[model samples]
Target: MSRPPLPPFTRDTAIQKVRMAEDAWNSRDPARVALAYTEDSRWRNRSEFVVGRAAIVAFLTRKWEKEHDYRLIKDLWAFDGNRIAVRFQYEWHDAAGQWHRSYGNEQWEFDDAGLMRRREASINDVAIRESERRFHWAAPGPRPADVAGLGDTPE
Candidate 1:
């Protein structure tokens, strides 16, 4: 049965979870990343909406497959009770060798258990030449940090 939508968007845990999600996406391993959500996490990414972990995996697989050299970096936007907003951009080369920089935003809702209950995203892409591209979608994180960009924390 379908359930009600999220109540509100505010919480510290949710913010941390969002950061973890950003880290996973920047990892570039969709398989590993998919595990973060509930087994039945519901998501609306751009135009496609998917449910369950298997679907999330499949969706990510197809996405990374066509969007080669995929690199994603997400920055914290805002936070509320159990939701967080994010602004992110990724650069990827399509199968036809066309490079695109996709700018997007997302609103994430979490259950009491802190697992993502719902996700809604919007994206728009702009084409760019290889030389003009900066975020090559290649990194352990978004950037090297020293250059004043986002990067993974040292463990």
Candidate 2:
């Protein structure tokens, strides 16, 4: 299977890839998200290490189960050859309804087929009041184009 806009990316292709990833993740559908990765993709998300698409599916299933109302946005940081880096922010409420905004960076290495073969992410979550939330788009869907990305605000 081939995922396109493959490799040695131009700036436009890299940005499109980032947006596609953001939209996939916002769907919160583990199976759907797993399609972006290779069958044997390796990932280190926070403190957990996961390998393979089956594991990726299980991990995301558990994540969305606990992180309710999850909304995410990923901004392209850089890209060269087969690698791309992204900075991201996501808002999610816990099962107990406590809100949080997570900040993170991810480095992704994709195969020539344009499927990510490796991903390493470092993330930190800050508890925030529900009123302090920035993402208000409908859940289980893509972020609307009108919503501003991380670049729109002072960093």
Candidate 3:
């Protein structure tokens, strides 16, 4: 059976949800990240579609396996009623020590229960040097409360 009607998506809630999702992803725990989505969550990251939490888990597992030392930072782009759009930049190094930075945008749709039901994203990848890195959130502590909108803040 198909999923039910989507909830009233708004900018605020969407940003909040995106924050939690980012946290989970940055944690690099596939299972934890999958839990934020609906059981049948559907997603397209750079054109590949993966449905359901199981697939999300598996996809993330395979993703992290190939991407070592992954770190991500997502910024809020815009938000309507029930949908929130985001622009993000991430850094990761491969097993061979090749550093890369990816720029992307994501659109998210949430269900009534507050679980994300659908996500669409487009990303562009480029190789970069270690000195070009931006997110230096290194001194390990709690992440900012509002990471999505923390554009140039000390976050």
Candidate 4:
């Protein structure tokens, strides 16, 4: 199955792709999110190396289990040919109720079919108090239209 906004992306399409990904991740459904990648997709998320959709699903399952009430935002950083780059932030609390915000940059390479074949991400986390949270939208949902993006502030 081919995903839309296929490669050789324009500015608008790249932005659309980024938002689509952000929305899918916000859903926190591992199986649903795995469909966006190729069957043999490869990923480097932080220090972990994962390959294939099944592995992706397993990885996400473990992740969401530990990251309670996760919310995410992704901004398109650049795109060319079949590749796109993104900068993202996400907030989640551990089982112990300590909140942490993660900042990351991802490089994605998609096949002609628009399924991501390779992904590389580098991320860092900073602990924050509950009151310091910037993303206040409901969990497992898209950011509201009224909510500002990373570009809106110097944070």
Candidate 5:
């Protein structure tokens, strides 16, 4: 199955791919998110390594469970051929109600069908007060158009 805006990416198509990924992740639906990857997708998220869609689904399920009120933004860093790199930030509170913002960079490699086959991410989190949160859209929703992206302001 083809996922289109299929590789050999132009600048515009790459940006569209980034936005589509951002929107899918914002939905916080593990199944929906996993669908963007190849059936045998491999990922390194922080120190954990996960392989295949089933593993991806399990990992995301655990993540969203611990991270309450999650919101994320992803900006295109670069792209070529079937690879795209992204810089991202996300905010969420834990079960104890401690708020944190995570900053990360991800490198993605996609199959010819435009499904990501490998993803590597490095992320760090900083504790913040709830009042300092910048991503205040409704839970499990996309960032609205009026909200500025990471490109607009230095963090």
Candidate 6:
């Protein structure tokens, strides 16, 4: 099955793809999110290496379990041919109620079918008080239309 907005992305399509990914991730459903990748997809998220859709599911499962009340935003940085770059930030609290915001950049390479075949992400985490959180929308849902993207402010 081919995902829409297939390769050789233009500005609009790239932004759509980014928002689609952001929405899926905000759902916090590992199985649901894994469908965006190829069966043999490979990923390097932070320091961990994961391969295949199953591994992607497992990795995300472990991640969401630890990252309580997760909320995320992704902005399209660039795109050309079958590759896209994204910059993102997410906020979540640990089991101990310590809130943290993560900043990252991801480079994605998609197959002709539009499924991501390879992904590389580099991320850093900064601890913050709950009151400092910028993402105030409900959890496991898309950011509201009224909410601004990272481009709106320096944060």
Q: Which stretches of candidate 1 lie over 4 Å from their true place?
A: 1-15, 136-143, 147-155
Query: What residue pairs are clashing in model 3?
Result: 9-81, 9-82, 10-81, 10-82
Candidate 4 structure quality by residue, lDDT tens digits, 1-155: 99999998999999999999999999999999999999999999999999999999999999999999999989999999999999999999999999999999999999999999999999999999999999989889988998888898457
Model 5 residue 70 CA deviation in Å = 0.4
Error of 1 at 65 (Å): 0.2
Q: How high a TM-score does candidate 3 get? A: 0.83
Native-to-model Cα distance after best TM-score fit, residue 134 in candidate 5, in Å = 1.0
User: How many clashes show up in model 2?
Assistant: 0
lDDT of 6 by residue, 1-155 (tens): 89888998999999999999999999999998999999999999999999999999999999999999999989999999999999999999999999999999999999998999999999999999998999998889998999899999477
**Per-model TM values vs. the true structure:** 0.79, 0.98, 0.83, 0.98, 0.98, 0.98
Model 3 lDDT, residue 49, Cα: 95
Runs in model 2 deviating more than 4 A are none
lDDT measured at residue 118 in model 5 versus the true structure, 0 to 100: 99
| Candidate 5, 12-66: lDDT as tens digits | 9999999999999999999999999999999999999999999999999999999
Of candidates 4 and 1, the better by TM-score: 4
Give the TM-score comparing model 4 with the true structure, all chains together: 0.98
On the 0 to 100 scale, the lDDT of residue 60 in model 1 is 84
What are the runs in model 5 whose C-alpha is more than 4 Å off?
none
Positional deviation of residue 116's Cα in model 4 after best superposition, in angstroms: 0.2
lDDT of 2 by residue, 1-155 (tens): 99988998989999999999999999999999999999999999999999999999999999999999999999999999999999999999998999999999999999999999999999999999998988998888999989999999544
* Lowest lDDT block of 10, candidate 2: 146-155
